[model samples]
Target: MNLISKLILGGLITASLHANAMIIRHDVSDGKYIQQAADYPAIFPLKDDGKTKNCVGTLLTPQWAITAAHCTILLEPDSQLEIAGNKAKVHSIHLPPEYGYMKAIKNEQGKIIDIEDKVKDASFDIALLRLSHPLKGVQTFPLLEQKVNVNQTIEVMGWGDFGNGLEGVSRKERVNDRQLRVAHNKIDAINGNYLIFNFDAPDSKNALPLEGINGPGDSGSPALIKLPNGYFVAGISSGGDYPGVQTHKREGKYGWQEYYININAMTAWIAETMALSITKN
Candidate 1:
């Protein structure tokens, strides 16, 4: 892939790079999540290295990008999410109004003890970014106007690692092996504020053979819907649950439930934020 030529087709459905990092792995080790890369300029890869956090971001317009709120923080005025051999300097960030952060309370052993208190509103995990420069050439995706109907097929892409198994791996391990991968699944449920997609594994006899599902480091991946008119951004990869009851456990049947920030629910916020970005410049 000639990197720069990686055009975001219509709305970033196809990958400019044939082979992207695997979004998720179902089988044990060496499992392949996605077969190819989603050759789209907006398909950003995520990497959270504590010192600096990384997450996927989609170019909605020349001057604006969208991503997950928890993917990163509002930097101290002058930093950017470096991605795709380029950097989109952060001009401003707009998070959901109801969103609030809870500091992680860690014990003497350094283990986070207050899981519940640190929980934020997962419903409005979406955030919009005003970039210092416009991503040239690639087609920017528009937010979906209508409500997402059930059974609607949606495409998701990210650079998540595969094969965390039931004992899902850590962000550091995933970042080491992450690749830009793409997969598709139908909307299984709607939570008013989210688009719930069920990503089944290849081993699941009765479920859809969706190759991959969102995993750690895929927080800001775009949930794209192919409308009759064109492709649109319907959801942002807010979070997901894997198979088995054990939380954060990797593997088992795909049975991954992915939650995306309902784009329609934040329509006004998106516009208001983008407009504000323009005013800033």
Candidate 2:
């Protein structure tokens, strides 16, 4: 199966873990921007029960957050966004028109049945969430409007799930009290709206000090880039790619390809969406 198909199947075909994505080959303490809770308050978790994180999102404004479109299933009226010990209710969601092309088949229980063949447009795997109220006192992230080059280093932050690339993502590491972790990886390729990265082995020459990739439970997490001025939201954690390796598979081991929805390509759509929200209120 293709990498995108495998990723969609892993989440839809398999049971929902409702956990956060973990960073392989890195510990929480080693994170430069995510070591403390207050460091990057803009990053938060999207939850249905006001606790269990279904996906991660980055704050664009006090009332706006950006995440993957597939995560919209969890953003019910009662869904909550937890950030820095504060919880905000999700008011509404917005998606690109092309997202309609990527349909998901669900069973009677509202559980996703199959999306392997239905995911037609991976390029539009992006979404914006409007919160009921403004997240006062919290800083928001700026969208990356500039083009990103391949091999550019980016900072990835997410919540929950923990393990090294060697063992892959361990179910034992999935925790309820999700811990936020950060790691670094360089973009290996760019495909349409996606920025791709290969999780290099620890000893690999191209490996960063905290080289890692997103594992299950981290969908919608932000891939941040530190520009000369400040930090920018460069991409969103969309899925993973494992071509031929049969053993480790999508366990987030070395050689896994991480696909992030490029944010620079959708800045215009994001601006227009946020403007619509302003017009509504």
Q: All candidates' TM-scores?
A: 0.71, 0.84
What TM-score should be assigned to candidate 2?
Answer: 0.84
RMSD of candidates 1 onward, in order: 9.7, 3.5
lDDT (CA) for every model shown? 0.58, 0.75
Candidate that would win on TM-score: 2
Q: Give the runs in model 2 whose Cα sits over 4 Å from its true position.
A: 13-16, 26-34, 48-52, 101-118, 170-177, 244-250
- Per-model tally of clashing residue pairs: 19, 1
Task: Quote the lDDT for 60 in model 2.
Answer: 83
Candidate 2 local accuracy as lDDT? 0.75
Residue-level lDDT of model 1, residues 1-281, one tens digit each, is 11101111100221111112334444533433343444566665444443322457787877777887655432423565654456667777677666643233457985434322222455766777777887665567888888788888888776534443344444334334444556667777887778877656556553444545555445677888877776789888766654344344232235656678888888988888777768777
User: What does candidate 2's lDDT look like per residue over 1-281, in tens digits?
Assistant: 35564565567445333666665663324344246647788887776444655677888877888888877666666576686666888888888987653455678997666653445576788999888898778888878878899989998877665666776775445544566678889999998888989989877899987788777878888888997887889999888856565444337777888889988788888898899878988
Error of 2 at 220 (Å): 0.4
